[model samples]
Structure formats: C-alpha cells, structure tokens
Target: MKKNDIIITYGTHISKMVRMVLDKAELALSIPKNARIGIKPNLVVAKTHDSGATTSPLMVEALIQYLQEHGFYDIIILEGSWIGDDTKRAFSISGIEKVAEKYKVPLLDTKDDTYCKIQAGPIEMEISKTALDLDFIITMPVLKGHCQTKITGALKNFKGCLSDKEKRHFHTLGLHRPIAYLNTVLHPGFILMDGLCGDLDFEEGGNPVPMNRIVAGLDPVLIDSYVASAMGYEPDEIDYIKMAAELGVGSMDLEHANLMVLEKDTCPVKTIRSRKVQALAKAVTEKNACSACYANLIQALARLEERGLLSYYKKHPVCIGQTFRDQSGNSLGIGSCTCRFIHSVPGCPPATADILKGLLTGLNTK
Candidate 1:
C-alpha cells in the first residue's frame, strides 16, 4: 500500500516479476549502473524451486540482470546452505553457477566470512563480517511454511548470513520466534520474496505447494505479513509478527496499507490447510521441551484460570522436563497416545489428565 508497503507479482519469468514488483512500488532504487551488488537468496537445503523448499536461482539471477540493466556490475551471488551441503555444491547443483557465469558475477559461499557477535533481544548471535562492508544486500527468500514460526519470509532469510554453527543456536533459542527477534536487529537493505513455489507448512521441512506468487518489500514485517496471508493464516499465528509489531517493526495489517491487488490475481488465496494437508507440524530436536510447550501451556492455563480451576501448580513451577531444571511441586509429564515416544497417558509433553488435574488440583471447586 501507499508507495512502499508490499508489492505482489505473479509469473515464472524472473525478470518480468522483478520489473512488475518494482513498477508497482513506483519508486526507483538509485544504485549506480556499475555498483557492487550482492544477491542473497534462500539456498537452504539447496533443493530445486519445484520442491517448494529453496529460493529459485532464476529469481536471484533476475535481480542481477535488473541491476545490471540499471547500471550495476561486480555482483556476487551469495548463500550458505548448511553443514553437509556445501554452498559451492548447492550453487553448482542448483544451476546458480550457470547464472553467475552467464552474468560474470562471483559466487560467494558466505561460510568463509569473518565472524562477529552481536547482541539483540534475548540472544547473542554471530553474523558475517561482510555485512559491514557491503554496498547493498538484495535479499531473495522463498516464501514457505515453518513448523516453529509458521512462515519464513525476509526476516528468516537472515539465517543465511550466519555461519552453520550459529544456526544450531538459533534452533536452541526457540526456533521461529527467536529467529524473528534476531532479524529485527540485522536489517537487510532490500528484500524480494520468492513465492514462485513455497511449502505451505514448515518453511524448510514441509512439502511444496504450487503457489505461483511473489511478494517484495523493504520492510521484513510487510513481507512476512504477505507470506502469512498466502499460507491462509493470520499474522497473529506467528509470534515474531506480534513481537515485531510490538517492537515497532512494521504493520502486519496490510489491508490498511496501500494494497494494490493485481487485476490478474485472485482477491486472496484460499487457506492452504483447507486443501489436502501436506505435512504435520513437529518440534525440531534441538529445542528444549519447555520453550516449545510454554505457549500452549500458557494458553491452556489461561482457559483453566478463567474457569476458576488453576491453583494446584502454585506450590511448584510445572516442569515439563528439560525445558527447565527442576520443579517445586507435583510435576506431570505428557506424551501423545500415538507417538512411539509416548509410554502411556502421561509421558513427556504435558498430558490432558495432568492438565485437567492441574486445573482442578488446587481449586476449591466445591
């Protein structure tokens, strides 16, 4: 909306989408015709675009061509995939090298960048040193579902800028929400979201859904809001969106902004979950169970509290195992009936009975 909120475009032709997005924005980015530009993309997993997993290289190269035409050169195609998959290998396998060769741009595997630690929000993170010296960083991220945060957009793409070792810690800090908090401080200069193909659930893990759409914007929150809309969910479903909004990141409610729906596009996409569900949300192994269960438990507790049935746990902090060190009262564990990880009604997570008991255990229901 307005001159800057978010630009939505449709098409597989990379150049056409870039031009359409910028045209819709109605503003020109005044970079030199021969300035140094870096094309940073979501090369996570190094999978092809059809997999709905990674950023499409065609889109990244498209930005390069657009920059070149507008008087830019000395460009570098940068990405840091993961541990086992080399960025160089992913670049070659995904045909990023071909695009780089065609454009004579350097292919940079950012894992080699000198590291710098920066503290923000509740966590301290390590980032690439190249960030300080870059003339401009053009971000291209695949719009997809994430098990932890719901959807990954411009902000999540910042994970690519960190070394693989640091990424492990990102998971440690509570996955999705922590990552969003981390990105708010490390702002990228420009962001062009690649939605040509995206996983409807779990950004990097879920099966790809064919949603041929792209959203571009300078505001990471705006881009995230668009991706949330595309996934058929509300912005509040994502914790970071709420946190970012509270942190004065940007508006999640884009309907109030300068939203210009293309005449060629549908009014809005149907909720993806309404269709055949492709994947189930599961917690990553790295997170302690407490941080993972805190939100849900809090919600359940609130409901119980409203019903005047939440007093048992006052004697002790309900410890859900590793999430915290020890509990002061009667601690109960829960496990899903269907999971092999479950031994019985009470296992590890926080069982329904335990919850009900907790709700009524200390309350004067009489």
Candidate 2:
C-alpha cells in the first residue's frame, strides 16, 4: 500500500478529526458487514474525561457510527490494560462502557480469559484468545508521547492487547526489541489515531499537549513516523520505530510517504525525549578512568538520573566504547587481570574518541 493515505486532521473536538482522518484511508468496505469485529484502543490507564491520555470514547463512537452508516454495526470494543488497573473498570470510567451500550456491542476485557502464551522467538506474549478469534480487527490508538519511544502510536497500543506478563517482560529486552517483534506479528487492518491534540512528554500520567491532529494509516511504522515528525522528534531517535524499519514492518522515512496533510497548517513540533550519553574506551594505563572507575561514574550518574537528580538523561541511549588509557573495559581487552565485578556489557566496547565525538555532535544539534 503506497502511502496508505495518512490523514492528519486538526482541532480538539476529536471525533470530527478522527472521522476526517479515517474516512478515506479505511474505506467503506463490503467485507462481511456484520462480522465480529474488534476495535482495540489504548485504555492503558483510567483518567477523567478525554484529557488526551487514552482513546476518547467519542473517537471510537465516531468510528462506530461510520461503520454503522456503511451498514456494518456488529462490533466489540476490546482491550486489557497490562497494569494492575482493571480493564473493565477503566473501560467504564473512560466512558467506553456507555459507548458499548449505546452501540449495542460488547466491551470484552481480555484479562478475564484463560489464555495461553505463545513463544514468538525468544519472547512470549499474552494475546487475547477471543480477540484473535474475531473476524476483523481495528486498531484504534491515542497518539501520545512515550517515555521510551518518542511517540506511542498504533503499534505500542497493540502491546496492551497482550497479557500483563508480556507487557512487563518487554522491559527485559530494554523495551525496544520485544516491541518491534510484537508489531511484526500482528497489526491492525486499519489504524486511526485519537490524537486531536494528544500527549507529548508522557503518555498516561503526564501533562497533555494539544497536538490537534488525528492520523490514520495502514502501516503502523509509517504512522508512528508521522506522529514523531508531528511532535518534532527525529524519527530515528525512537529505537522501536527504527527497529520496525529495519524489520521491513514499515518505513520510517517520509520521502516515499504518500501522506496527505489534511487541513493542517503544518505546525513544527518540538523534538524532545532526547539527551546526551557517551562512553569512552580506556586502556589499562589510567586507573582514574579505568573500567571500574567508569562503571562507578556511570552508575552514580544513572542513579542520579533515575531519582530525577538529572533530567538530561531522559530517553537518551548511552553510547559507549572509545579507547581510553584504561583497559578494564576496552575492545577485546588485552590485559584483563583485575576487576572481577561485572554485570552486562556489549560484546565490543566502542572507542572513547568515537563515543565523545558522537555525543558532542548529537548534543550540539539539539
């Protein structure tokens, strides 16, 4: 599908923007009008009103109305919040339960099912048995800023579709790998973002920003790329989006994008969630800058960052491995006769000069 026609409509009354964004990309299809359809939304947390946190019920209602007008009304609004918060409770609180009643559809919370975990490569994800059993699925996500990934688009929203364990386990692979893998396996037939001025810095619990934009597309990766650009972030800054591009899940590059900026004034958004991180390769010659010393230094820095001691380290990937005069952590260490304490290190340590250079350049541009 060439551009898949991503629609980025503006304004706050979300449903209007949602309908405008989705009207063309997801056409009035004739595929079993009364099919058992599932509309997956980002009910990640329970918040009052739209608040630009989760998918607005009005946005889903708008889609339901669209489908109904097209003679397809049988559908189920399904979701399961991975966090301990009750998905059913969240649905009811978020106004989705009332939408289900009005639409005459079921609000199925997948957490209630006796599910089985399937090994998708080295990772196991808890998927909804009932949703998977559906004939049609529609991925409806609220476009927002993510702590790890710059923007949480349709793909990240799908992570909620899996069981709770799978969602938490993703942190094991550092948050990006498992996300990329999961997106490759399952994708929505159509993606409609409930953006219309969504989040920018944080997704569920952070203050909201008015992105006044609702985008829809077939390619989850491409949709994310658009959301990132709209948010003024370098698409490549988000590793998950990059991973999706590398896996051919979808393209992050917008040059080949057949995007239709519907009713947008082309506002330039800020590129946040980026910072400076670097590691130096030190030879055994210097003790002050040795591997252990660097470890302690980095550990202190990381601890400080974690406690909000340093705000600059947020969302920045640590780039390391330039050769220093210390050998405790060098590429294929020639003299490794000391320092028995070690946790995890990449196979090859990058040179100190390279790491510093990259960091300097990255920070200067920002």
Candidate 3:
C-alpha cells in the first residue's frame, strides 16, 4: 500500500475484517521473506478486548495467520503494559497469550527486555532492545481517548517500546515532544487500528463506545490526524501529531489521503462522546502531570462523580505533578511530588483505587 493510502473495513467478524484489510492493502508484499517482524498491540491494561482497553486477540490471530500464509514466519508479538500494570498479566487476560501459543509465536514482554539508548531530534530515550531488533513493526493500537493528550493512536502506542523509566521520563518531558520524537526514531511500517470499541474518556478503558471497524494505514501521523478529526478534534489539537509532521515523521494532510472503504454503507458517522474529562478536570490544578498519574486521578474523580461526591473537590482543586515538588499546600495533592501538602495521597503515580480511597477519607473528615 502507498504511504498516503488508508483502507477501512467494517464488520463484526474481526478476523475477517483484519484479513480483508491486509489483503486489500497488500501489506505482506512490502515485507521481505526473512524479515524479523514484530506485532505490537495495545495491551495497555489487563482488560479483555471487549473492555476497549486492548487490541483484540482475534485480530492478532488473523494477522498471524495471514502472515504465515503469506510465507512470513519470522513473526513475534511484543508489548509492555503501562507502568503499575503487568505485561504478562495483560497478555494473559487479554487473550493474546493463547493466540501466541496457538500460532507458536514468541511473546516478548518488553517490560523485561533490555534497552538501547536512541536519540531522535532533541530527545533521547531508552527503547527496548527486542523491539529495536525487529526488521519491521506492525502497530495495532486501539483508537481511544487519553486524558492528557486528548487522544491516543498509532504514535502513542510506541510508548510501549520504551523502558518503564523512559516512559516516566516522557511524561515528565510534557509527553507531546518526546512522543513525537520517539516516532522519528522508531516508525512502524504498517498500522492496523482497533476501532471495535474504545473508552470514551480515559485510556484505562471503563466506558466503552462501539465503533465496529478497522483502519489501516502506512503513516502514523496521518492516521493519528484522521483519528483526531474522527474523534471530534482538529489535528492541531494533538501536539505530538503536528510535531511529528513537522519533524518529517509523516504528513497530517488528510485531505490528500487516499481513503478507501471496502464494506458498503457501513462507515458509521463519527459521534462525539461527552467531554466528561473536561468537566471533571475543573477540580484539578495540574502542571506537567504524567499520563498514568493524571489518568488515575481522572478515573478516581469519575468514581467520585458517580457517587455524587465529586463536588467536595471544587474548593480543594487537587494538585499534582513535578512542579509541586518542595512546595507546601493546603489543598489535597495526588502524588509524591506534593508530599509537602497537608493532604496528600503519596505514590510517584498513585493507583486509581488509592486515589479514590484518599478522596473518600478526606471527604468524610471534612
């Protein structure tokens, strides 16, 4: 498929949908027979594919079957879940382990893999050696909402290839620039997006909205730009996408993209989910917060909102992020950086449940 070509197929049969798109795109023709291929999927959390936090194992299996059928056997599945989550557990719970076992393909958990320092543009980060060893990468990221970046797609999925330390560092570097730079270093040859169902607001995936389709493309920036527009935002709203385009990663010009839809009259009109995160974020006073920490706080606030307890934070406006370091505060703080705060739930990036518990306890005392 050409770099500017994007193919879409719609159906409930994920395996058939994947095979149809791959075949039509002629993705196999682009790879050499002896190439070491890595299938990177979004196992960001230990949730089933139905939960909308992960890529479908059925889709992965279909890709594997298609590759093997196309005489491509040097294939492996590799991924690392977000920090505070176990990759092994995610693989198992997400049904990807069984798919690997059935196909007799190796599953490399990048969390346990060694790293190599790579420099891209002005940013340098440690990427997994196993990921770097691959001749080509097929990124399968779930199209989802991100609390921090507003959206997550092809470019954001590459964060899984970074060491856990580098992942944290990316967040500290404000996420956007580092993410854009990471793609400049490790660009995937092909992208197959899981548009089946993705969480509407948070990356961790609790509230799912079903949009039964699969999107295939060669350009991450272009695909992400399309994703941003489809998800009710302008391409420029996502900083990394625009930065990656500027850094020569890929074009964000969707107008020139050759979009082809296979299935007839099945492309659902994109609908915008309520911006609950925007409303909930009013209670937060954040500065350079990491994705994980910010996500946990958002989920916690969502839970509080459900219980009609979110109002307790209007006056408090919970503080979080690196800038809170060495600063004393009277308001509730969410992470270890705000240790000087009178009320603090302390972890470098505290768990959602723990954040909720802390908020509940504070509410009771008040």
Candidate 4:
C-alpha cells in the first residue's frame, strides 16, 4: 500500500476480512520476498482477542497464511506485554501461540530479548533487538480508548517493541514525546488495526464496542489521525500523533489520505462520547498526569460509577500527576506522585482493579 492509502473493510468473518484488506492494500507486493518480517500485535494484557484488549489471532494467522502464499516465508511474531504482565502468558491466553504453532513460526517475547540504545530526534531510548533486526514490521494494534492519551492506535502500538525499562520510562517522560521520538527510530512497514471491537473507555478492555471493521495503512501518523477523528477527538488532542507529524514521521492530513472502503458493512458503528466518561473525568483534578496512572484512575472511577459509589468523589476530588509530588493535601489522590495526600492509591500506576477496591474501602472510611 502507498503511504497515503488507507484500505478498510467490514465483516464478522475475521480471517476473510483481514485477507481482503491485505490483498486490496497490495501489502505483499510492497515487501521483498526474502525480507525478515516481524508481526507485532498489541498483547498489552493476558486476555482473549474477543476481550478487545489484544489483536485477534485469526487476523495474525490470516496475514501469515497470506504471506506464505505470496512466497514470503521468513516470518516471526513478536511482542512484549505491558509492564507487570507476561508476554508468554499473553501469547497463550490470546491464542497467538496456537497460530504460531500452526504456521511453524517462532514467537519472540520481547520482554526476554536483549535491547540496544537508539537516538531519535533529541531523545534516546532502548529498543528490543529482535524488533530492530527485522527487515519489515507489521503492527497490528487495537483501536481503543486510553484514559491518558485519549486513544491508542498505530503510533502508540510501537511501545511494545521497547525494553520494559524504556516502556516505564516513557510514562515518566509524559508518553507523548518519547512515543513521537521512538517512531523516528523505528517505522513499521505496514499497520493493520483491529477495529472489530475495542473498549471505548480504557485500554485494557472490558467494555467492548463492536465496529466490525479492519483498517490497513502504511503511514502511522495518517492512520492514527484518522483514528482520532473516528474516535471523536481531533488529531491534535492525541499529543503523540501531532508530535509525530511535526517530527516528520508521516502526514496527519486526512483530507489528502486515500481512503478506500472495499466492503462497507451495513449498520456501521460510529464512536460516540460516553456521558459516564464525561461525568467521571469531572471528578479528577489532573495536571501533567502520566497515561498509565490516569488510565487507572479512570478505570477505578468507572467501576465506582457502575456501583453507584462515585458520589464519594464529588466531595473529595481525586488528584493525580507529577505536580502533586511532595504536596500534602486532605483530598483523595490517585498515584504515588500524590502520596502526600491524606488518601492515596499507591504504585507508579496502580492496577485498575486495585485502585477500584482501594477507593471503595478508603472512601467509605472517610
């Protein structure tokens, strides 16, 4: 596919849909037959693809099958689950291991791989060696909402290729700047987004909203900018996308993007702003907050909202972010940065479920 082209198709048959997009995008023709191809999917958690938190094994298998049929055999699937999660377990739980076995393709857990430092723009970070060794990389990211960045698509998916230390460090650097810089150093040859069903409010995925589509493109910035618009946010609202555009990663101009819809499904789904998310966000007092920490708070608040326990937050607004560090307060706070507060959920970015339980127990005591 050309860098400016974005091919899309819709269906419930996951394998057929993926093949359709790949064929239409001319993805096979764009790569060398002898190239070492790495298929990178978002396995941020140990969850089934239906959970909408990870890429579908059916999609990956289809791509692999298509590649082999096209005379490209040097293929491998690699990924690193988000910090505190196990990639090997994710591969099993997500059914990717079965796909790897079926294709006789080895699965590389980047978490266990060595890394090399790379400089991009004014920033330097370590990336997994396996990722750098690949001649071509196909990134398959789930198009989903993120509490901090607002959305995660093609651009943010590259975070999986970094070392665990670098992944954690990306958050402390505010996520956007480092994500943008990383793209300069590592560019995916192609991007295939899982738009079938994705959680609309959180990245780890529980509340899946089905859209029943697959999107393929060559430009991360262009695809992500379109994703931002589709998810009800301006491209500029997603800091990394805008930054990547400025750093000359790719174009963000959707007006010029060649959008091709091979098969538009009937009753197409469109993203709408969640009233619950709006109400929950009002309860947070954030300043320069990290994505993980903020996302955890949002997930916790969402649980509280569902349980009809969010009323407690009305009186005690939740505080989060770097600005809250070393600051003492009587209010409830959400991360280690806000530890000085009277009530704080500790951890650099505490687990969402833990945050939920902590808020329920701690707020009840207040």
lDDT of 3 by residue, 1-366 (tens): 899998976657788889889989898899877999999999999999867689999999999999999889999899989998999999999999999999999998998999999888777899999888889999999987888998899999999999999999999999999999999888798999997777765788876656666899999999998777655456898999999999999999988999898873233223323466667778888876664466557657866786798887976799987789999998889989899999999875565567888888889988
Report the Cα RMSD per candidate. Answer: 14.2, 14.5, 14.6, 13.8
Error of 4 at 36 (Å): 0.3
Best by the lDDT measure:
3
Q: Write the per-residue lDDT of candidate 2 for residues 143-216, one digit (tens) a residue.
A: 67677665788778877777777677887678788888787767677787776545544677444544455677
The candidates, ranked best first by lDDT, are: 3, 4, 2, 1
Relative to the true structure, candidate 3 reaches a TM of: 0.74
TM-score, cand. 1: 0.68
Q: lDDT tens string, model 1, 2-64?
A: 425666655445667777776665324544444566778887776676666787777777777
Residue 19 lDDT (model 4): 86
Worst ten in a row by lDDT for model 1: 278-287
Ranking by TM-score: 4, 3, 2, 1
Off by over 4 Å in 1: 1-4, 26-35, 263-366
